[model samples]
Target: MDGSKVALVLATSAGGVGRHVRSVADGLRERGAKVVVLGPASADELFGFTESGARFVPVEIADRPHPLGDVRAVARIRRLTRDADVVHAHGLRAGGLAALARLRTAPAPLRLGPAAPPLVVTLHNASIAGGLTGAAYATLERVVARGAAEVLAVSPDLEERMRALGARSVGLALVPAPATPPSPDLAPSHEPESSQDARPSQGTAAPSRAAAVPPEDHAAAKRIRAELGAGDAPLILTVARLADQKGLPTLLDAAAGWARLDPPALVVIAGDGPLEAGLRDRIAEENLPVRLLGHRTDVPALLAAADVAVLPSIWEGQPLIVQEVLRAGRPLVATRVGGVPVMVGDAALLVPPGDAGELERAVRRVLEDRALADRLASAAVERASRLPTEDDAVDQLLSVYDRVMRTVF
Candidate 1:
């Protein structure tokens, strides 16, 4: 590699970051820089970087307060950063890993002629932390900020949040999320039997938002109705982590109020996390028609089959799933948060975050008024088209890599 040429040390502790890291790394590679991903096992399991032409190095992440794990993470990062012209961390885990890396001692790698790569952190979410633990996280973030050479915030919401949390010394840049609206096609190439392909095919276009809707997905909806023995049932889908912020409990409470006349209305909550057992129990106890799907890649098809897509999150960081929902051209009923307003634009029926009654009314209105659903879906499609495309997001990522490399050399 040329001494001036750059390298990226991408890291993440979640599935979403894999998409962003791979997109950025792929873009950087296309722009002629060597890129390496210091991602987690989950990220690797979800998105295989090796097959995508980038080197994948495993880096275990410590979820704050784990001093020993932090030390190990830093040591691992130091080894990965060796010989790299620029070390750019992708998300929060990558940020912490990069900060830890700076603490590790190393004789400069022989490959570097003069310039040493500066450490960088990219903040993807606006919330630093929540509740009592936030103070500790804030202090740690400030410490990390002081060690970093630059801090990139994906959204203005994130930038403001960081500023509020007291991130001063690090050079800050608002990188505006570079995600594009999904493809318009309504079918995914992978079959129902092959859903375990898990990782996406390398170099494939980012999954189209519209592809979330497949004929089979609609059939699944029909199947659910058949199982419930309620033919011609109206369906509402919520694809999100079942947590407080995602507002699942509130959604279920609201589901209790829906009065189905001729055909019963059903609310399907897909994707799973900490709140699964509680949510299942709540459904059983309350006798709500809401069904819980632990987790399914069949989401796109489910979204397509549904009457409406609801994201009642108290907060969000430019949810890719929302983009997928929009690409499916489904009417949206979402809580206004983070870059959600930016995603939904005027297409979605927005409600105050955490207001179950309002959420209920929004869904009911869409269900009762087919014209409104059609209008919302059409508007969603138009708004989705206006947002940046995956190609555009890739270009912006390349620009970031190029700009960071310039700072190093």
Candidate 2:
């Protein structure tokens, strides 16, 4: 109830945690909370939290499990938590570290501080994707449940998964990452040029379907189309990594069949992975008009530049690009996975994951129906308007801090 600032402590190996952490940190700052972020060296550099005018503490809890690195990270976090008003861990490593730091040496014979910060863990995703580290995954979940005062989930699926993983009495919250609207609405600049040249070779190999569109990327599409000599045709994009879980193979086959039709639809995939060489080889063998664009930073610009945004992930925990593309107010054709349906709502055309036929038809439908495109764009614009503003998110976070602080005082 009194006036006091809280500190936000976030950790992540990589990926979306950075996004969530940044949003939280910015929110906290807006609410007058001092934030301290801990993460891998790469994250510290890439995210540039310090440049964003927040304090950043480096914690090298690598994406992969390493016994020594994990132990060291926990110790570093323990030190940081001493002065924290609230310790909220964003991902598994940070959560486990917070949990371990708060572990009782024996049955708690006594209480410690008059105002110990409440420890909260936001379950970002199921670490079942951890493979052989499956046991480690279970252990991490247990530690977070035991150590943290609350568990916050980003989606309903993850919240249910948290319960199944032994998180009892969870404070279920469907806190999807906030989306920012485009700066200066970029309408279609010119009559979209014929995209025939941007089409990839039917026989070209593709990377994983989990590949992502490049950031600030728009020029490459025109370049690819010009190279392929098919710039007049309609171009569709799917942004994700080329991993098996992303359903790249199914999309590729669908593109092959779609190519045999009139008006010639082209699919461009932007991302990188171990599947790159294999995907390219498969494209060559099967002859599909799919192009692979390695990791791009200009994704927002590309979202503005493209005719449509497509997401085809087999399994996902709320992909950020889908939210971003929607915020750009573009029509989207996405597989029904993760929080995509939640983000797109009625704004996007949905297709089943890994269904090439469905994906192909959806893309074709988007191309043929100008009225449908306008409708989706209007709906997307409306949906984007409903997303949590940074100020609102900050206010909610401050409320969480007050709630957490009340327990301590």
Q: Which residue pairs collide, candidate 1?
A: 180-388, 180-389, 183-208, 209-327, 210-327, 212-300, 212-301
lDDT of each: 0.64, 0.66
Write the residue-wise lDDT of candidate 2 on 1-409 in tens digits: 1324444555543456776777777767765666778777677787778888988877777665688877787677767777776787777767776667654431341243444567777766655365668778777777776666677776667677667766544654434455644433233434433333223322211211111222223344455456545555566677787777677888886787668655566777878876899999988887788878778665665565466778877766666777677676777888887656776789999999988889978877766666777678778778877765556655655666567666542
TM value for model 2 = 0.80
Question: Across residues 133-193, which tens digit of lDDT does each residue of candidate 1 receive?
Answer: 6765665566556655567775557666666655542333333233444333333334542
lDDT winner among the candidates? 2
Error in Å for residue 212 of model 2: 22
Q: lDDT of model 1 at residue 136?
A: 54
